[model samples]
Target: MGGNHAATGAAAWIAVTASTPIAFGWYPVSDASVFTGALVCAGAALLPDADHHSGTIANSLRPVSNVVVKGIEAVSGGHRKGTHSILGIAVFTAIAWALSLLSIDTGDALFGAILIGPGIMCVLLVAFALKALKITRDTKLLPWTMSVTLAVLIAIFAPEEWYWMPFSVALGCTVHIVGDLITTNGVPLLWPLKFRSPYWMRNKRGLELDWMWRAGGNLSLPILGDAGSVREWIFLIPVSLYAVTGIVWALLDQMGYDTMAIWYQIVAALPF
Candidate 1:
């Protein structure tokens, strides 16, 4: 797992790239727009891990995620299988595109029902049957229950473009796959064929290009090991810097500042 931090970093990088003048030459972006895009990208980064029952995505979605995780595991023979493959990317992207085409009203209604119905029922059932079901002591369900309810409420009531939601999710999933490529157990980039990154990136000397191919595989940092570890830092730090710089430049450009001249001024002001 790239963990939340790495996943977020990847998403942030994507968001920053998308916010660039070059990337959005045909489109306009405001602060709100950039923020929304960033949020979507970050959320999408976690989509690939939907198959992992204990993962953040699964946990957030709870009961529904339970079913989804199990189903994916059963069909794919476990994690890092179908969902991590190129075919999986295509499938997810298609789903996102399709979802983007959904009528706002229809989508809101359906999502509202899914979120509210289960939550209300769960609340009523728990309240009435707490003692009867011997569930009085366990309060763990509350968090997920509340989360579902709140998420749904936000999804339905919040003002948003709506169409980009699915695309953001798809983008996140794609980022997850790319993030996994750094792991020791590289993703099945081409599933069914089961071609892992190591095999393809191996040199003629019969050695895996560990540095370039399995970068995350070598992480040994403490606490955030394997996720925001040293290896991740190597890629994340530079990308983050670039993203921040881009955001600043964009904002300055929008404000009518000569961003390049500003950069030169900052450099000139340095003690060195």
Candidate 2:
């Protein structure tokens, strides 16, 4: 899946999850916490594509991304290898869970450092030094790094409820894998037990399945197609409607509105 589509899918998931009873067990207590969890999920959604050197995440992270991508590619042998597989999601989930187990107090201290004078200055100085040295050809890298750095700092300092952090990250990763399943070259979902997209969805010359993939693939354009495309709408409309309904229902419930009663009233007013 394109980076933008992955992001949109993740956002839609977050919105729907936030507004539904399904996520009640994992829900955070505060709005700020909810937003933090959503952001983490969104970032994690882009992590699998870290192996694609030209990918948005990689372009955003620069020299660090170059190193990270190269390392992963070396071990995995190419794009859509380990990171796009079931094994990757499990490993990442485990890592997130382990990180969650760390003393919250320690995270708080590091968070403080990231926000304070010396910590902020240290980051700025390093960025400046890197820019002056021309160590990276991508000028956007500095700003992207700074933005990501600040986001991480906020996540650490402000801190959502512990348990949901890992869950949100893992959910994001899972969403990414699912999104890639619809692409021209479907993801290696099962990895060692490789299989292509089901027969119904397979590409075959002159067949409907082939045409579907071609259209969907074109609509899956990462950033641009996300703006507004019929193909995108085909996927987005139903999901967006579902998510909006959930969000509205959740909001009304929180506000003490009798949503069911309002729905009944609207239905009664409708002409037969």
Candidate 3:
């Protein structure tokens, strides 16, 4: 589910950035920004699940992650409750926006030399992404190192505008909610306000259903049955591929490679 969430997050970012009719071209950022935002979004996709003590993100680190998870669990009113809500998304976006303003360059040598603001944010995000994607499994060291390296590279070469941070966070978190909404256990999008199950979904005999409704219950489509179901895989695989292809295409386009021209040449050479 973590991997699936990450994939959806990346795919959503790509889709939103794409200049297509379906996307509406909301974010007209540079190719580099799109690529960077996609990675950040991928990691943030798993952030809402931090309320689950046993989740991959909660267990990714040691005492720190455990402590954070406990805190989130306590505040969010258990797993899949508050952290999966609209309020949670707002909070996350606000925090990201605040951090985006913390960058320092020039005058302050310490801040200028070190990747303080968005750098740290990017490091953590990319690290979590690597962990969630299983690219740095069995050890946290590799993810940390890779994250730091990418952060450093971004600080050196990428543009300084951190305006996209909040958007990426919001998109990632929202996509996460959408992903969970399709599972057997749905997320509470509008928390702090309980919702009764629609008459058709009500189960009079089950105390669990009653409790869920009372605790600002879940909102689900349940098309995937459960997390990591075959349906989820079937849906996510193509999305992940689309994200990868978009990233590659963006990079190539940035390098001034006209893919359309190559495609036309290939088509012309092909047999009719």
Candidate 4:
């Protein structure tokens, strides 16, 4: 689930960025923004899982993470409850937005470009994303090092604009929820606002839509049957390919390669 969510996050970011070779132009495009936003999205994709005490994000740090996980679990009314809901997305985005504002008052950057608040946010979140992606599971040092290095680079070279940061967080979380909706257990997307199941939903044998009302509206589609199922893996193939392709294309374009021309050549060379 973490891997799938992470890939989806990157793909979602690529889909929104105009700077990428295959995307729309919702936000202003830049080499730095493109990559930074993708990483942020990947990290935020795993953010909702913090509610699960035994999940990846819970043990992401150590004792501190455990305490934080317990707090979130309690406040969120257990896993797949508040943190998986629309309200949770709003709360997460608001927090990210607030941290982004901290950069505005920073007359002197941390390293000539790094804003303390956003820089710290990026470091922690990006580190979490690296952890969730299992980029270096054998040792935690690598991810932390990579995150710090990226943060410093962003501070030094990336632009100061972060208007798109909070929304990226929101999009990542929403993508996570969507991922859950495809699973058999589903998620309470509308926490604390359960409704009676309609005739169609009530008649379904496996899904207890009305029964789950107390926990929240457990809106699910069950297309993938269950988490980590073989069907899920099959579904992830195309998504993973898209994420990889977008990332590679973005990087190539950043390195000044003519991606469009290459894509055209690739198409032309393909067998009919």
Candidate 5:
């Protein structure tokens, strides 16, 4: 149904992570938590797309996200300028986090520690970011809400493995943040602190064309600039290989886990 690239990537990442517990002996094939964890983690990774009114989950909650996005946009300006600010992150996370508390057995972790105990510190951090960016609202709250909801659902059901579920979900959100950051500039992940996380994607080669097309081939994204110098090419080539390597690794890991799941299923079904 026209999946988002970043969402698909997040799901694959969830699979990669969920499989690790099995690989490490923290859980078994029969564990409901493991299965639930895999499913929920995938959804959480894809949660940020709620910003798109046309998005699957977002479309379902048009009225709410529309209002939220509108309010945020009025307050913050537009994409990357406000909703990507710190206030946005906290407000987005708070609702999900509170809901999570009701459903899951939250533990202590970095995200949790920051979320709990005088946690106004973290919220203020996010708030300060929003204030600094002059960001007050967004046109895209649906995707963020949906993504965070999925994370909370996962947290409620996922079993404790390598780390806490909230932390894992928080980390998952970071992937979404970082994914977008690669495409745009002046992205302040944490606002109000005088720190700017500006990682841009404007190279003329490879996926630059595909990405550029999404922005309407606008002036901001170029077609073929210089392909950069040999040194830059060296950096670009290996970094580009990340896509290939990540795919292969995920595929092999999936096959291995599936094989294990099947074997265990057969054993459970054995007449002996």
Candidate 6:
């Protein structure tokens, strides 16, 4: 899938999952959390690829990303290896958990702020262990780790909201992973232990934008599949429909026909 497709998939999944807990009456969530959490997760899903020099995300961070990639390549024996390794997962998880502490609404004592971050880090480590053991590979479940980590966060800070919040967050992120798996090369939903997954998607013929260079300034403006053929139009319609439906749904929901807003989803999911 293309970057736009992948990102949209992430957004749709987040919207669906975020609504799950709210609809089920788990906890009262401010819109900010929902938006923040979704974007955070979607960002994470897109992020792993940043370990690669030529990836869309890698360039944005530039020299720092370059340094990280070089370091990982030195250690993992190549660009994607070390960063994709279990060791790297641990490192990144710790970093993210430590960073998450900054989001807490209440202040902590000096020691509390410092030690608390690592404590949160420990919880994230445990979640990663759990996913590594139980979820199986190639499923969107890897992203579920984001939800589980958030669950631990909820448990500590908003105990009452713990029940369904993680479920919603995981669902959204997993859906993004699932969307990607539909393409030719799938993810190892179950990693370390179980191996790969069964999901397969039809890969794109050509995405207009190409990440030929890793230097932040080189990504090409994506050209839609050719504008000249019937086949191109074939890809265009569904793509157009997908984009428009999302827009329409947002409009209707804003217009107060929220219940009717899911019409696009039904159409998208329909087996034509």
C-alpha local distance difference test of each model:
0.50, 0.53, 0.77, 0.76, 0.38, 0.39
Which model scores highest in lDDT?
3
Model 6: runs farther than 4 Å from truth? 9-13, 20-28, 72-94, 102-176, 189-272
For model 5, the superposed segments whose C-alpha errors exceed 4 Å read 5-9, 12-16, 20-39, 46-58, 75-77, 85-91, 103-165, 184-186, 193-258, 261-272
Select the stronger candidate by lDDT from 1 and 4.
Answer: 4
- Cand. 5 Cα-lDDT: 0.38
TM-score of each: 0.57, 0.59, 0.85, 0.87, 0.41, 0.41
lDDT ranking of the models: 3, 4, 2, 1, 6, 5
lDDT of 4 by residue, 1-272 (tens): 88888888888888887464467757655765777778878888988888999887775555566788899999999989889888889988898888876653435554354455666667767877777778766465676678778766765566464667788889899999999887877887777666545776666688746433323358778889789999998988988788777777777778999988998898899998
lDDT of 5 at 262: 55
- Find the 10 residues in a row with the least total lDDT in model 2: 215-224
Prediction-by-prediction clash tally: 2, 0, 0, 0, 18, 10
| Whole-model lDDT, model 4 | 0.76
Error of 1 at 93 (Å): 1.5
Q: Of the candidates shown, which would achieve the greatest TM-score relative to the real structure?
A: 4
* Candidate RMSDs in order: 9.8, 8.9, 4.0, 3.2, 13.2, 13.8
Residue by residue across 191-242, what tens digits does model 3's lDDT show? Answer: 8777767654455454345323423367777878788889999998789998
Least well predicted 10-residue stretch by lDDT in candidate 5 = 117-126
lDDT value for candidate 6?
A: 0.39
Per-residue error for 66 in candidate 6, Å, reads 2.1
Worst 10-residue stretch by lDDT in candidate 4? 208-217
Alpha-carbon runs more than 4 Å astray in model 3: 20-24, 61-63, 108-115, 159-161, 198-216, 263-272
Where does candidate 4 clash, by residue pair? none
lDDT of 2 by residue, 1-272 (tens): 34344444335444645634434534434443344444445556666665676655555446665776778666764677778888888876786676555443444444532323222322332332233224433676554576457545654555444446556657767877766655445566556555433555554545545322333222122321323345655776565454345545656666678867887887899998
